[model samples]
Target: MNRISMVAVLIAGVMPFTVGCATKKYTREQAAPIINKTNELDDLTAKNSRDIKDTDRRAQSGIADAQAKATTADQHAVQAGQQADAANKNATQVNGQVASLAGTVENLDNYKPVAESSVHFGFDKADLTKKAKDALDQLGGQFSSTKHFIIEVEGSTDSTGDADYNYQLSKRRADAVIQYLADKYQIPAHKIYLIGLGKDKPVEKNATSEGRAKNRRVDVRLMTNTGDQQQNASANTPQGGK
Candidate 1:
């Protein structure tokens, strides 16, 4: 119960409190790293999740773009196929017409020139003038009394332009003439053998305007079998010694 005993008791009591604080500090120190590590792991997991979401979004966008492009390409391919099919169908039709015409050209007899003509056109013209129509009408009238005649048509062009262009132009001009004759006189399409000679057979020089004009012409001739010609000639002969 003296000063030393009292001091000893006080020290004993303070020792227990200090020991408890030390133990608590040690436990906190030990758990502090674990808590800090757990927080760090959570932050890392969240960042990884965000990264994964961003990657997924980008992947989806890329896939969508690719799908759109693929669809567009497929559409283009379909259109190309349709165009090719149309072209093939047109080619088949043209081939059939040509074949039919070929069969009509095999007659062995009665192929002589009955009438001839030169249909002229102005610069870059595929249309017939009034004078050209009149000439065609006269030819048609003359042929009204003839029998089994086939018209041979040769389309020509001047040498003033590109050869291929001139060839097509000459063909158009010939087509114009043929169409006119067919529509006006009811001539059959098979009675015509037409060609576009272009600048290959020029009637005159293309250097001059007048010469070019002369070159822009279609030479047409009518031909008939020998039997028909003779019959017509005999019919036309005057009756003698009757």
Candidate 2:
């Protein structure tokens, strides 16, 4: 209603507005660096989070690959061990077979014969006559119980034939005798020793037919040591060494 009171009211209202403006200005100025730093920190935090996720993913993949490689290595080692065991077993079997063969060879080396003789054959014939068979049978009977023995069959041919033909014929005769002994007596194959002398060592003259017939013959030699002969004589008594 008065002039002084109106003035005072106007100053009070204006003063409040001015103070509010100053306070807002001060707050804006003070908060400017803080806002900028907060924005930068947010960006760095986001980048660090992505980097951690990527590292975790890579680590998991590496672990998976390592486990797979280890499994494969274990399987391969098992297979190699099996192969080694098979090789060792095969080696043992082969060694056993070799030992058996060596034993057979030793038995052949220790063999001794009981009785032997010579028998004549016709020219160019590889067969044995009835008389020749009979003689061989008698010789074989001398060693009835013996399981191992050596029979050396030496074949000779007459001079009536060519040298080469006589040699071949002598070989055939020797082979025939060996085969007969093997088939009839069930003798082991390693026990017999056959040789063809052809006309090299003729027991009779080759000029006459009778002498030539005698030359074309097979001579069987019985192997014997002094001790073996003595034992054979004791067993055979009057029959002697046949």
Candidate 3:
């Protein structure tokens, strides 16, 4: 009776241990699948984060490029404004000179031509030659002893080009002569009366090349109010004869 009872107890204990080992193996298999799925989700989250950072960097780069372009455009606009202002200032100076000359012409009748000279130029040229400068030097030499005098600078061009173009060319020629006189002799601007007549006041016939060349010239005349002053002095003096 004691041997049969001991064998029964041994069989019951072995059966309970086998059931516990099977339950532990099933729990490990389920937990392994859940952990693999969680790892896959973490990898996906990391990839998404990298993509977001790259996109943000690209957006910032684009914004910076746009700002750089805007700054360049603003710089170009400022440069253009400065160039325009400079051109306007040059035009204003030319206009003022023309106005001053016009005012001097009003009292032209009081003056008489005392000395005169002609300066010739090449075809479509406004530059003064050596001969032209020498002629001007001779003309200006009289100014040292002269008093109450004014200079008349009359510019004319050949009838070769358009009327408008000829007018501008004549003006350029006159300016060249005036510049030389003012620079070398230090002649004041107020003492000079300037005009551009173009082909309208040509000194020679435009039929020949020589004549046309002669026509492209500037006539500078030194005039004085000395005669008017003398007449005024005589009129103001006491006279014995009526």
Q: Which parts of model 1 have CA positions greater than 4 angstroms off? A: 108-117, 121-151, 155-216, 221-242
| Better-scoring candidate (TM-score), 2 or 3 | 3
Task: Encode model 1's per-residue lDDT on 7-115: one tens digit a residue.
Answer: 9999998998999999999999999999999999999999999999999999999999999999999999999999999999988987887775675577625477877
| Tens digit per residue, CA lDDT, model 2, 51-145 | 99999999999999999999999999999999999999988987886775576456555445556788889878889999998888877775455
lDDT-better candidate, 2 vs 3: 3
Clashing pairs for model 3 are none
Cα-based lDDT at residue 112, candidate 1: 78
lDDT of 2: 0.81
Candidate number with the higher TM-score (1 or 2) = 1
Superposed model 3: Cα runs more than 4 Å off: 1-105, 240-242
Candidate closer to the true structure by lDDT (higher is better), 1 or 3: 3
**Could you say which candidate leads in lDDT?**
3
lDDT of 2 at 12: 94
Best by TM-score: 3
lDDT score of residue 146 within candidate 1:
69
Candidate 3 clashes: the total is 0
